[model samples]
Target: MVRRMTMELAVDVARAAVQSCRDAGYQASAVVVDRVGIVQAVMRDTLANRFTLQAAEDKANAVILSGVDSSEFRLNRQDIRPEINQIEGVLMMDGGVAIRAAGSIIGAVGVSGAPGGDKDEICARAGVDEVQDRLDFAD
Candidate 1:
């Protein structure tokens, strides 16, 4: 049986992501999506750009569809498999990360609205890493 992520875990991850972005002085929106691209949590800073929500969702979708982080997609655009990129909601940009636990993809986290894509990616990574140790313990 596949181990499913819980809502509490999703909420914790989202809050951690928001805090990480705020600490970096960048207001952003963070989204968490299940392996199948279903949204689990969405957090937007008070001062974040209005489009942050959509951008975050797009990033998460991209990671889920491609089975790789959004930064990888951005860095390897030419090499990205066409079938993965063709997913309806996927966005080949930065700020998305796939969450893996026990060697299985559990979800994805996406951050957006930062001044630069790299900054967004950094914040997203920080957030994901925050819960990675706990996730490991659950195995």
Candidate 2:
């Protein structure tokens, strides 16, 4: 029943996410948060905008709160309760994705500072993919 994201994994995820953005020819920031929305790791590229840090954190937090990818929420934003928008650390953006371990959400990764939200999301997914092996579920 125990579920948690290790510090090593968190750092690895964050770093890989940032690297993905870099390889895509963008400088960005990436944040990794445990299931409770508590930040576990953060990384900002050398030239990333200062706001990218908060953007990344908010994106990840939004996923944790909604239990859905932030991109999914972004697509259905019009149907979302207005009160949800008022919550702190919630951003209906496309850059956050849930991190599943053993078929359960263990954490999330969010990337920002890309030219577009979709680009940020792409980098975030790359980060998760990098660690997928460690999170494989036993059938």
Candidate 3:
């Protein structure tokens, strides 16, 4: 079975993402999900639109389902993007990144509400980086 991150860790990651985006002058939301696409934690910036929450969750779920970052999945599978997007909670877009430790995927972090997906992804990576040390040392 795939391992999952602690609730505290998940929350930290989500908060970090939101903070990162805020630092960049963009209001955003972040979602952390287990390997099974189950939501573990969610953080939304105060100025972020409520709709951003669903976008963030969908991005994270896409990572869990594809075993890769959402951007790569979307780029690599363009032919199927049309049909894949029709699936509930599955978004083939950027701003989603897998959370990995010791070569294993523990979860994912997805960010949304930035002006561009790439910017959102940068915040997501920052969030994951915030907890990288803890994740690297995890048992």
Tell me the tens digit of each residue's lDDT in model 2 across 1-139.
8788899999999999999999989999999999999999999999999999999999999899888899888776767746676788887788999999888889999999999999999999999999999889522
Q: Best by TM-score, which number? A: 3
Every model's TM-score: 0.90, 0.94, 0.97
Q: Name the TM-score of candidate 3.
A: 0.97
Which model, 2 or 3, shows the larger TM-score? 3
C-alpha lDDT values of all predictions = 0.84, 0.91, 0.93
Error of 3 at 12 (Å): 0.7
Candidate 1 stretches with Cα past 4 Å from truth are: 79-87
Model 1 worst lDDT window (10 residues): 78-87
lDDT of 3 by residue, 44-111 (tens): 99989999999999999999989999999999999999999999998888999999988899999999
The better candidate by TM-score, 1 or 3, is 3
Per-residue lDDT value at 75 in model 1: 75
Q: Which of the numbered candidates is closest to the native, going by highest lDDT?
A: 3
Backbone collision tally, model 1: 0
Which pairs in model 1 have colliding backbones?
A: none
Clashes of each: 0, 0, 0
